[model samples]
Target: MRVQKIWGADIYRDGGSYGFCFDSDDGQWYEFFLKTRAFEPVSPESHQPPIIYRNGCNSGEVVLRLSWEEAQAFVAPLRYENRRFMELIDIVMTSGGTARRH
Candidate 1:
């Protein structure tokens, strides 16, 4: 597949689905499920849920490709609120109550 880089990991995308390959880590790649907001690792002979159809069909082939921006657009909306909330929590934790309203 067409390799894309995001957050130091090689990313593969087919529509909203994503697979992240980190060479520094183990021999498995992480597949992100949009519906559940969860991830599963895909190994050589042990792929859970059998990966995705497009992914399984196009394995190692660059047939289906989406730009990084398109991928981000599909993913950003999924976690935008959570990311903002996490930012708020970070401020609360690091700002020593300075960022809190009285």
Candidate 2:
């Protein structure tokens, strides 16, 4: 998925880095991290979104904040449906959310 679609969403900042939270359909939250330097240039410019590149490095990698089981349990449903949960998790994980700047 393109990062621009959710550019206006909440961005978490920690020290010199900034991260955007993405809620996956599978009930997981993924944080896409970018350096302060990288974000500073594009954050102030409205004409175009930031340019980010993931070159098999940890900096631009997406990290999971919650697992499907953890997230499902957190909501605490009145009744448990293992079968339905499994089916939905499989589908959701297959087409997970992504963030990329073009």
Candidate 3:
């Protein structure tokens, strides 16, 4: 895996997907997810039910020998969740307020 710098994290990519190793406030290198270079989320609510695929902070880590399959698996869910959440939010915003159906 080749290492690169992304969002201040040590990123690695082997052809199909990208991986990263970054430090947290605890100062440990956890498994960082290979997020899409496409969209960047602005609100915390933006990263919901489907994936928003943020730029800096990802879902998980990018360990050694991180393959594309593994990366996609990690990334796919996030986008799905984020997008779903945003859709819900859009519905609420259009409704003009937040209220439980119950």
Best by lDDT: 2
Error of 1 at 36 (Å): 25
Which one wins by lDDT: 1 or 2?
2
TM-score of 1: 0.22
Which scores greater on lDDT, model 1 or model 3?
3
**Residue 17 of model 1, lDDT score:** 25
Per-model TM-score on C-alpha atoms: 0.22, 0.24, 0.22
Give the CA lDDT, 0 to 100, for residue 94 in model 3.
31
Show the lowest summed lDDT stretch of 10 residues, model 2: 45-54
Q: Give the winner by TM-score.
A: 2
Better candidate by TM-score, 2 or 3: 2
Give the clashing residue pairs of candidate 1, or none: none
| Model 1 C-alpha lDDT per residue in residues 1-102, reported as the tens digit of each score | 222322221113432222332121333333321111124353321111212123333354332243333444333433222332333222223321211221
Off by over 4 Å in 1: 1-53, 56-58, 61-63, 79-102
Descending-TM-score candidate ranking:
2, 1, 3
The C-alpha RMSD of each candidate to the native structure, in angstroms, is 15.3, 15.3, 14.4
